[model samples]
Target: MSRLLLLSPLLLFLGLAYLLPLSGVMLQSVTTPEPGLQNYSAALGDPLVWSVIWRTLRVCLCVTVLAVVLAYPLTLLWLKGNTATRVLVELAIMIPFWLSVLSRAFGWLSLLSNRGLINSWLQSLGIIAEPLTMVRNEFGVVIGMMHFLIPFAVFPLASAMRSVDDRVILAARGMGASRMRIFWQIFVPMTKSGIVGAALLVFVFSLGFYIVPTLLGGGRSVMIAELIYLRIFQIPNWGLAAALSALLMVSIGAFLVALIKRAGVSTT
Candidate 1:
């Protein structure tokens, strides 16, 4: 009775927020269009929808990989650095969290456009005769997402690296293990959970991401999240939209399960 009372607020919040809304979406996916599996079948059968879903997956994976690559080294450096340097690096990572997603996307827009900072710099250096197209492409989307996700990846990675026993690393070194070998053989395996956690975080969020992908992709690449909006608002197909949302949920859930299983997370 006491435990139930204590948990009431959280349970209420979940009921009012997630479970309710998700139930509505899933219910509509099946029932709104005459109580059948037609929406699911139609959505699954649509080539365009499949393409968008596949693109979303690829973009999410790309961002996850790039973010992990960018973060792990910085995290290691942060773990090893002196107080001042660590403070600076940590502050750099934390700064992005203070900014809105839209602001970051638009900021990248300015930087990645033809007349943006990078292109102008290259042009000034006479590296190219004309500004290279960077924005409005899959490349821009990945770059923009990596900016947002690197900190997410870094936080977990830093925690994992910090948790690693220094004595173990020292023992490996004492055993004549090269720095690279010890890092690869010992450090990497120990950090697998953190890597998977970050990958799950970035991958799941990126797949359903709207603002950054919408701004950077410029319709050249259509992520499933954006397609859901287009279907709901532009095309006004609630059933189809709901079906796509269901698909997105399933994909994220399946991938999350795979990640958890791979990381050997003991739920019980």
Candidate 2:
């Protein structure tokens, strides 16, 4: 009872800060637009809306995959390295966290745009007569998202990896197991929870991302969040915006539930 009472403030804060606002948004999404399912029906019927949603999902999946793949090696290096080296690598991963999203997007813009660094270097090297179309497309969005999400993916995996029993791993190695066998059978299995957690974090973060997609995607790469922004601010269609927002929430909720189930399975 005392512990429950102690946790009440934190629970109340979560309810006020997170749940209440989300519930309000959900209500607005369904309640507006003539108080019917018209908005949802429209969202369902609109191919353009579906396309944007698909693009968002595709980009998020790509980002999650890339982050996990990249973070795994980096996390292993961190685990195996000396304290100083590990700290340096961790700091390198976190440098971007301190930087603003707009700044990071602009950095990519400079690197990927025509007449930018990559193009100038390519031109100097005589690789092509003209610059490549890297920015203002799905490629740029994926790169930016991967950059933003890798650190998040790494931290969770590193934390989990740190908790793994080194003696158990040593015992496996003493039994003549190869390094690959040991990693796959022991280390990877133990860190499965962290991998799922990292993937879930990356996916959820990607789902709500707006700035990176907005800046790098140009007009061609429209995401659901960006679409909702346009509906509300650009088109002044709050009802439709609210409906889209509701759909976004539903999608995120469904993904999270699925992730939780997967994580539970891995832990068991």
Candidate 3:
């Protein structure tokens, strides 16, 4: 009872800070523009809205995949590296966390733009006749998102790895299990929780991303967040913006539920 009471302040704070605002937005969504669920049907029926949703999902999947591929190796490497090497690698991975999202997005633009460092070097080397269109596209968004998400992916993996019993692995090795065999059969099975957790976390973060995609994607790459922003500020459609926000939440919730169900089945 005391513990429950202790948590009440936080619960109250959350209700006031998060739930209240979200409820207001959701309420406004339905009440505005004639008090019907037409906003949802209208948004979904529109091809452009659907396209934006699809693009958001596609980019999120790509970001999740890339983060997994890059993060797993780095996590393993971190475990295997010497103290000094581990320190440096950890510091490097954490740089993203230290930097603001705006800084990171601008930094990518400066590095990937036509006159950016990469283009300058490539041009000076005569590698390409002209600068590549790397920035202000899907490619740039993916790169920026991957950079933002890899460290987040690594944390869960490292945590799961820490739970692995080294002695059990050593025993398997002593029993003539090859390194490859041990990795696939033992290490991987143990760390799957981390991988799944990281993937889902990264995917969720990618869905809410506003800065990297909008800025790095050169305004052409419109995400759900950016769309919501435009509806609220530029297009100035409060009803549409509220409806879009609700839809975004619903879509994300559905995906999370499906993932949880799938994980439950796999574990069983």
Candidates' C-alpha lDDT:
0.88, 0.88, 0.90
Q: How close is every model to the real structure, measured as TM-score?
A: 0.90, 0.86, 0.89
**Candidate 2, which ten residues in sequence have the lowest lDDT sum?**
25-34
- Candidate 3 local lDDT, 1-268, one digit each (tens): 9998999999999999999999999998898878998887878898989999999999999999999989998998888889987998899897878999999999999999999999999999999889999988889999999999999999888988988999989999899999999999999998998888889878977898999999998889899999999999997888888999998898789778876875677558
| Model 2 CA deviation exceeding 4 Å by range | 1-27, 258-268
Model 1 scores what on Cα lDDT? 0.88
Alpha-carbon shift of residue 195 in model 2 (angstroms): 1.2
Off by over 4 Å in 1: 1-14, 258-268
lDDT by residue for model 2 (1-268), tens:
9999999999999999999987877777677756887888888899999898889989999999999989998988887989998898878897988999999999999999887899999999999998899988999999988998898999889888988999999999999999999989999999888888898988988999999999999877988889999998898877788889888878899988987787678668
Question: Against the hidden true structure, what lDDT does model 3 obtain?
Answer: 0.90
- Count of clashes, each model: 0, 0, 0
- Model 1: per-residue lDDT, tens digit, 73-164? 88987888899989999898989999999999999999989999999999999999998889898999999989998998887787778788
For model 2, what is the alpha-carbon lDDT of residue 233? 87
Tell me, by TM-score, which candidate is best: 1
